[model samples]
Target chain A: MRKLGAITQRELLSLFCSPIAYIVIAGFWLVTGAITIWNADAFGPGKPATLRDIFMWTPFILTILVPAMSMRTLSEEYRSGTFETLMTAPVSDAQMVFGKYLASLIFYVIMLAGTLIYPLLMEVFGNPDWGEVLALYLGLVLLGIAFTAFSMFASSLTRDQAVAWILGAMPLMLLVLSVYSLVRRFEGWQREVVQQFNIMGRFGQFARGQVELDGVVFFLATAVLFLFLTVKVVESRRWR
Target chain B: MIEVRNLSKYFGKRCAVNGISFTVEPNTIVGFLGPNGAGKTTTIRILTGYMPPTSGTARVAGHDVVKESLAVRSVVGYLPEAVPLYPEMRVYEYLNFRGKLRGMDRPRREAAIARAVERCWLAEALTRPIGQLSRGYRQRVGLADALLHSPKVLILDEPTVGLDPTQVRETRALLRELAADHPILFSSHTLSEVEAICQRILIIHEGRIIASGTVDELKAQVGGQRRVIAELKGPQAEVTTAVQKLAGIVNVRATADGGWTRLDIAANNNAQNAVSELAAGRGWAVRELRQEVPSLEDFFVKAIVDARVRQAGAKEDRR
Candidate 1:
């Protein structure tokens, strides 16, 4: 456990010491803030007092942002040859993966926390639905968890960070955009099956203030599966 | 203590380490000497528990490297060839991180960091970021991190590769001091560096250990042949023939330069006195007569060449 904490702490220190973390966080805020202003009608007097636009656009923005955040987690270690020193330490492969994953998750949460000001601003101008807003935030956190794990798994596959980002972003874009598009093209049970795989569709339920157990399980399980794959990739070094 | 038996590693179809075996006992330093691509790094990696051997086994501190890797890793300190480090981290922060990774408590970590800093002479560079430091300082930082855990076994790959001469001398002194308590196995391609520090040398070539012994033992293995070079003011043919007739002379080659003839004589023993006697008998003026002692470099080259010749012979026999 101590080893795990050490890995996470080192990762966090590396993250904050570089300009990448701040650039990523600032980019997230700029995009979200721009979208919020473009959809100013949602916060006007006669409309519903909900953060629907912000919640709806976050998953798409995260498709790029989360991958950018995680692309260097393992890839940089490989490129710098620090992977040798790290693996030769007493920590297990699982602990290493979990430690790095935890650091990125913490950073994602911190970046998300900055958006709390939007809800505070909403409270001053008009009464917003607090329960719906909380559910949306919960849904975003779960989605971030899955996204972070998948991108970290991608990072484990290569030494080049740019390649890792593309490897992570391509599948994520397909999961969020393609499935949502395919949902409209299907009918009956076909549409239902596609909806089950659609990340945005699952997240839409939370946007409507419905906290489904299936959505929670899906996100958590996806995170675990990818994290497990990442561990396997790290272990593969011994054989290769 | 560390023991490896018939360890082998293959990357796809290419063999990186092939059936190599050696042991390092307590309170001794063994130099893993080899040219590039000679499997030194691969063998060190296996013993340090960074990777498992494809065949056979290695044990460190009585723990199996494959089955009890974590236990092995906990007791071993490794400095890789490149001295990989988190460039963004301060030297002290990096050492603290390594201590934590080794599961050291805060108080113990502090003491270990101080000891390592003092030993590696890293007091001045502790606050500087690793990337900002020079290559030599980065190497010292790596050495400091390796000593932080006070490991029972230390495996270093080319620890002095990038250091200046003074730093190299200091590192050699440091390794000797560390060897009083911990068994160390370090790899180097520089024969002189290994000759200066290591008590035992393992010479690896083409993925195999071609020769291994003490400096004198290896020199003896190449037959201890000495060469006597004589520059005499005499006829080239007479100088060559007379030197060839001398006792202990194996072969002699003469070359003419201006008004002098130089004879290079290979001998089983000292031929300096015999060559000088012949020069006096022939009324030739002796300019220079000296016997050259065989060095570790000669043994290393001979060992590699002999191995390659034997390999070629084996291939020929198969046909």
Candidate 2:
């Protein structure tokens, strides 16, 4: 546990020491804030403005931003040869993987914190459902966690951060790709399976203020599953 | 302190470390000598628990490398071939981070870091970012991190590859001092450096240990046929024939240089006495007669050539 904390702290220090973390976080807020303004202004006054624009657009924004944030988690270490020193240290494979994953998640939370202003604006200008607003934030957090896991797994696959960017974005791309024909082609429980498997589909429940256990389990399980694969991928490199 | 038995590592179809074995006793320094791609790094990786052996076992400080890897890692300090480090970290920060990973508490870690800094001569560079430091200072930082834990075994791969001559000398001296308390197994391609510091030398060829012994021991092993060069005032043909006819002489060649003839003789034993006696009997003026002994470089070359020949012979037998 102490080793994990140490690695996580070192990883966080490394991430923030460079400009990449700030660039990523600032880019996320600028994009999200701009989209919020455009969505609120472009709508007809005839339709009641809700916080829908901000909550609905977050997953898409995170799909691009999370990969950029997590690309250097493992890949940079491999390229710089520090991975050897890290692995040879007295830390377990799981500890190393978790430390890095947690650091990315912490950065994700900080970036996500910037979006709180949108929710505050929503409450100030009009009547909004507190439960619904809370659920939206939960959904965003869960989605970011799951995305962080996939990005970490992708970082484990290659030494080049650019390649990691492409690889890490693949899962989220496939998730978005499912909306077209991929979902329409399925039927019955298979259709339900695909729907729940879709990140946005599960998130839709939380957006509606219905925080079901099934939806929560889906997001948390996805995070755990990918984090587990990240550990396996790290261990397999030694054999290679 | 370290024992490897029949260790082998295969990468796809190529064998990187063939079944080879050696040991390092406590309070001793063993040098791993090999050409490029000779599996020195592979063997060290196995010993450090960075990579597992395909077939065999290595034990470090009484821990099986594969089974008790964490224990092995804790007890072994490894400096990889590339000197892996976090270039963005300050020297002291990196050391503290590594010490934390090794499970050292605050006071102990600070104490260890101080000792390592003083030992590695890194006091001035402690606050400097690693990326800004020169290659020599970066190497010292890597060494300091390795030595911070005071492990029982030190496995360094080409620790002095990029250092200047003076830095190399200082490192060699420090390693010799450290060996009084810790057993060290370092690999290097620099023959003279190995000869200068290591008490035991291991030469690996094609993933196998082809030669291992003390400097003089390897010299005597490969320097089987003693050689002697003599300058004499005698008939070239008669001098050559006379040297060949001398007891224990294996071969003889004579080179005439105007008023003097030089005889080169390969022999299994000292032929100096017999040659001088022959010169005295034949009334030839003997100007010089000196025995030639092979140096480490000569033995290293001869060992490599002999290994290749033996490999070729084995291949032919199989065919």
Candidate 3:
């Protein structure tokens, strides 16, 4: 618990010390607003404006913003060699991984929360489905957790932030591109395996107002899997 | 206290630290003397639980480094060669953060931070950003980080590497004071610093401890023979031939001045009477017969050279 607070405070302090949080949050909101306004059917004879449109743009924004945010999480420590201080502290690998993961997740949450202004704005203009808006925000939270964990795995790979950003972005890109193409190629179990790991495919159902247990499980499992891999990678470094 | 047994680390096929072992007692300042690429840093990292040995086991503070690592880490303070620090933070903030990492809270945390600043002499720079500080100030911050929790063991690595002379002396004084309470195992290529403070020394060469003993013992071991400079008055050939046939003489060289001879006596293996017997026989008047005192620097070079020569001989014998 103490290690958890220490890591969180240190990471938060670093985040606010520079312009990373401001730039990332602003970029997220600007891009998200532009995409939501373009996609919304507010001015046409279509469905009413809901947070669904706003949230539909979140994963797309997060796909880039998360990597930018998480690129330096562990990479900077490995590069600067302060990780020796972290490793030699009286903290378990689980604590270390979870602490760093939580800090990134909180950052994503703050960025996500800042975009709530769009939904609140839609509430006054149209009679938006509050239930659907709430569900959309729920889906956004889950997606953030999954993205944060996966990006942390990339951050653990190398000390260079550029490499970490590339590695973090690549998998999400593959997942997004994989579902549409790979799902069409296979017929049975192979297709099931391909789509199970497809983040965008699962997210598509939630955005379309469907809440499936399988989708939530997919996000949770994916988050836990990458976090476990990160912990293992960090622990293995002690021997070398 | 620390104990390492049959410790070795291999990267693929190349052994970085071959089966080397040594022990450090409590409250003693032990110097780890070695040149670059000698695996001194690797050994310190292993002891601090920042790395693990490929084989064998180590016990630090009565806890297994591999098994009870957290327990060991709780009592150990480590300063890596690079002194990892977040430059954006203020000196006081960094120390306070480090204190929290070590499990101290509130009153204890404040007290530890105060002590660390006082010990490192970082009081004036407490509110200054670490990036704005000079290299000397950065080093003091690193030391303050190590001292924050008041750990029982301190592991410092080439701490004075880039410091000026004055900073080096101040750090040396700080280490001397620190050694009275906590055991310190510091690695350095600076032989004079080691000679002045350390009660015991471990000479590392090519990932192995070639010699571990007092300064006098290592000097005698590495500087295998003692040389005597004699000023004599006589015919050089007669004096040389007389000394050549003597019992204890291993090698004799004539000095630039016609009558003097420099004798390299085989150290413990030879007796002193043999030189006197030859002098008595030749009736050469002796003026100076003083022993050359070998400094630690000379012994360090000699030890490394001797180890390489021995290794080469062993490789040849194997073939």
Candidate 4:
């Protein structure tokens, strides 16, 4: 537990001290704001505004940003040689993994926090459905957490940051790609599995205003599995 | 105290550390003297419990390294060859974080950080980012981090590799002070510095202990005899005749300079009395007569070269 706190503190300080967290949050705001303003016709017009515009764009946004934020989570340390020191320290591997995971999770949460102003503006003008708003935000956060886990896993796969970035980008691309009809090449239960496993399909119920435990479990399970794999890699390196 | 036996580490099929064995007593500063790619770093890593041995066993502070590793690691402070550090953190912050990781409490850990900063001369950079510091200061921060929990045993790998002369002297002073109460194992390729600081020398080559003993003891292994040079005012024939009459002189070689003869005498042989007697009996004025001393470098080269030859012989035998 104490080790977890140390890891968390180290990751948190690094995220804030560097421009990583601010750049992530600001990037979200600027991109979403520009799109919203331009589509709403900028200054004075029949701009049918909704809270969905801000969050409706995040899975697509985080498909890029989360990888950028998490590409260095374990990858940078491996490249910097701090990963070896981390394993040599008296802390357990589990504590180290949790520390890094939670740190990135918190940073992603801050990025999500930037979109709060979008909802605040929604409350002033239209009688936007608050439940759907809440559910959509929940889905974005869940997906982000799940995606961050894989990004971290990818980061752990290699010491080269560029290689880590490419590896981190693969899962999000595949997660989006496996849902397309090309997945039918499997031609059986695998096809049925792919159709249901679509991340966008998982978000459908939530965006339309319903709570889905299945998707939540999926994201949580993915995070645990990938982080566990990262820990195993560190352990094996020590043995070798 | 530390004990290692039949320790071998195989990375895939290639062995980084072949079977080896040794013991280190408490409060002794032992130097691992070896050249590059000689498995010095790999051996230190296993001793510190940072990595495990593939076969055989090791024990530190009465705990088995593979079985009771956490207990060993809790008391063993390590500074790897590369001096790993977090660049974004301040010197004090990195030390504090490392202290906590080694299980020190908040108050005590903070105090330990302060002491380490003072010991490593890092007070001025306590608040500055580690990346902003010079290479010397960065190495000091690495030392400070290693010293932070006050572990009973220290394992330092090439601690003074890239430091300028001044910083190296300061680091050596700090290490000398620490050696009073802590058992330290420092690895280095330079024999002279280790000879000055360490009480014992461990010469390794190709993942094996080539030789181990005090500097004098190791030097004595290869340096089995003493060489005496004498310059006398007499004919070369006369000088040679007088010296050969003395006992314990194994071989004599006369210089081309006409009046000088160099004598190789067996260990424990008294050559001065022989020369003085020769000078007294012959009435030849003696100018110079002394035994030449051998340095650690001479011993190190002899030991490592012998080990390499032996390893080659063993490999050929296997084939």
Candidate 5:
């Protein structure tokens, strides 16, 4: 665990030292805050502020923003040839992957946390349900974890961060699109399977404040699967 | 404290390191001398547990590199050819991070980082970011990182490649100082550096070890048949004919310049005595008679060419 932490600490140091991290954080907040304010005006003070539009826009914004934050996690190491120095150290492959994943997750969380003022503003000007707000934050955290893991995996696949960004964004876009797509031609069980696999379908329950155990498991499973794949990809570098 | 048995590495059917084997005893600095693409870096990578060999086995500090890679890595400090480092990190921060990765506690990490910085002469650069340092300082930082864990074995791949002459001399001095306790294996294409530092030298070519031994041993082996020049004030043809009959003499060539007989002899042993005796016997005035020993650079070049020629011959014979 200490070895993992060391790697994570180094990752965080590099992440913060570069200008890209600050740019991504500032860009995410500016876009998300603008969208939330416009949606707040549409909701108006007469209606109960449900933070629905903020949560609604989160998945799409995160789909792009998360990739920007994670594209350099492993790709920059490979590009700079520091991967050799790092891998040759006493740390194991699993520790390196997990440490980098944790660092990206923490950065994502920081950016996600920046949007909390929107919900707080709702509470001040209008009556807001605390339960729904908590669930929305939890779902956003889960979504961030999933995106961070997948982007890290994409970063491991190539040495080019731009290529990694594209690789990470394409799958997330398809995931969100598939959730709301109308599949009228599919049979009953097939349609059910497709809908159940949708990220928004699981995340939708959290937005509604239902707090379903299955949805929590689905998000965690997706994050874990992608993280595991990232480890395997890093280990395969020896073979290459 | 390092051993390899028939190790080989292939990158998609192209063999980067062929079946090469050698051992490094403790407290000795062994120089790996090779040309470009001679598998020096590849072998170091495998020994450091950065990559696994395609065949055979390697042991460092008595731990199998493939089976107990973490154990091998713990005992080995590696400085790669490119001097891989994070540009954003301060020198001390980088060393401390590496120490932690090697499982050193907080106090131990601090002590190790301090010692490494002192040893690598990086005290002034400790607070500066690595990317802003000069090339020589960056190389020193790499050495400092490799030394941070206080590892038993040091594998340095072309550590002095891009440094200036003074830096190269200082690095050689540092290696000599470190080799009193640690077994060091460093690769270099620079023959003079290897000669100045290493107690034992392994000359590699085409992913194979062409020659291995002490400096004099390699000179006597690959540099067979020594050369001696003799200039005398006598008849050129007569002196040449007379020197050809001397014992231990293989061949003699005579040239007359400025009314002096200059004879160049290829002989098995010190033909100096025989030439002098002949000059005294003939009662002729001698100008110069000196034996020339081939330099390590000459021996290295010859050995590599000889290995390539033999390899080509073997390939042709197989056909």
Candidate 6:
């Protein structure tokens, strides 16, 4: 456990010490803030007292932001040859993978936390639905966890950070964009099956203050699956 | 102590490390000498538990490298080639981080960091970011990191590769000091560096250990036929004939320099005394008579050449 903490701490230090983390956080905030304000009409006096727009647009922005943030997690290690020193340490592959994953997750959470001000402003100016706003934040957090895990898995697949970013972003973009279109094109059971895989659609339930067990389980399970695959990839490096 | 037996590693169809075996006993510094693609780094990686051997086994501090890799890694300190470090981290922070990864507690980590800093001459660079430091300082940081855990075995790959001469000398002295407690196995292509520091040398070639012995043992192995150079004031033909006829002289090449003849003799016995005796008997004035000593470089080249020759012969026989 201490070893795991050490690895996480080192990873966090590396992440924050460089300019990448700040740039990613800033970029996420700029895009999310601008879109939310545009949708909310610059949060004008007569606008609805809701942060739903911020929560809705976050996953879309995160598909790019999370990958940008997590791309260097493992790929940079490989390129710099620090992977040798890191893997040779007493930590297991699981510990190393989780350590890095946790660091990125923590950074993503910090970026998410920055948006709390929007809800606070809503609460101050008008009577916002506190429960719905909190639920949306929870959904966004879960979505961020899955996105970061998938990006880190992509990072594990290559030593090039740019390639890792593209590899991570492409699938997520396809999933986010294709599911909505597929939901419309299909009918009956076909639509139901596609809707089941619709990430944003499921997240809409959270926007309505519904924290269903299956939705929580789905996102958590996706995170775990990707993290496991990352561990396997890291272990396979020994064979190579 | 570290032990490897018939360990091999193959990357796809290419065997990076062939079936090779050697041990590093306590208090000894075994220099792993090889050319660029001679499998030294691969062998060190397997021994350090960074990778598992494709065949055979390696043990460090009595733990199997493949089965008990975490246990092996815990007791081994490895400095890889090129000394990869987190460029954004400060020197002290990096050491502390390594200590934490090694599972050392705060008090112990502090003490270890201080000891490593002092030993590696890193006091001045502790607060500086690693990227800002020079290559030599970065290497010292790496060495300090490897020492943070006070490991039972140290495996370093070209620890002094890019250091200046003074830094290299300091590193050698430090390694000598560390050898008092740890069994260090370091790899290098620089024969002179290995010759200066290592008590035992393992010369690898073409993914196999072609030779392994003490410096004197290797010299003796390749220096079986001695060389004697004699400068005598006599006719070249007469001097060559006289030296060739001597009891121990295997062959002699005579060259005329000014009015004197110089005989380069390859011999199996005391050609120096025999040549002097022959010169005195023939009334030839002897200006110089000396036997050349074989260096480690000579033994290294001879070992590689002999291995290649043996390999070629085996291939021919198979055909």
Compare the candidates by lDDT and give the number of the best one.
Answer: 1
Q: How many backbone overlaps does candidate 3 show? A: 0
Model 4, B86-168: lDDT tens digits are 88998878887888788777999888988888889988899999889888988888888888888788889999999999998
Q: What docking tier does model 4 reach?
A: medium
State the lDDT of candidate 5 residue by residue for B114-214, as single tens digits: 89889999989999999999999999999988888878999999999899999998999999999998999999999999999999999888889888999
- TM-score quality measure for candidate 3: 0.87
Displacement of residue B101 (Cα, Å) in model 4 is 1.6
- Could you give the candidate ranking by TM-score, starting with the highest? 5, 6, 1, 4, 2, 3
Measured with C-alpha atoms, the lDDT of residue A127 in candidate 1 is 90
DockQ agreement of candidate 4 with the native complex: 0.56
Docking class of 5: medium
Q: Write the per-residue lDDT of candidate 4 for residues A1-240, one digit (tens) a residue.
A: 677888888998987877766787788779888877765643223454445544455566677778878877787787787876776678887788778889898888887787777777766765567888888888887888788888888887788766787788766876665575366576788777786667776766677667778888887898788888888886777876
What TM-score does each of the candidates earn?
Answer: 0.90, 0.89, 0.87, 0.89, 0.93, 0.91
lDDT of 1 by residue, B1-319 (tens): 8888999999989999999888888999999998999999999999888888999989899999999999999999899999999999999999999999999999999999999999999999999999999999999999998889999999999999989999999999999999999999999999999999999999999889998889878886776678889899988887788788889889888899887998888898778898888889989998999988788999999999999999999999999
Candidate 2: TM of chain A? 0.92
Second chain of candidate 6: TM-score? 0.84
lDDT of each: 0.92, 0.89, 0.82, 0.79, 0.89, 0.89
**What DockQ was computed for model 6?**
0.72
Residue ranges of candidate 2 with Cα displaced over 4 Å: A41-50, A122-128, A180-187, B225-291
Provide the lowest-lDDT 10-residue window in model 3 chain A.
A40-49
Cand. 2 TM to true fold: 0.89
Model 2 complex DockQ against the native: 0.74
Error (Å) of candidate 3 at residue A17 is 2.7
Candidate 2 lDDT, tens digit per residue, A1-240? 879989999999999987889999999989887887777664445455456666666677777889989999999989998999988999999999999999999998998888788667656766667888888788888888889999999999999998999898876876765653387789999887787676776677788877889878877898999999999999999998
Model 3, stretches more than 4 Å misplaced?
A39-47, A181-198, B222-292
Whole-model lDDT, model 4: 0.79
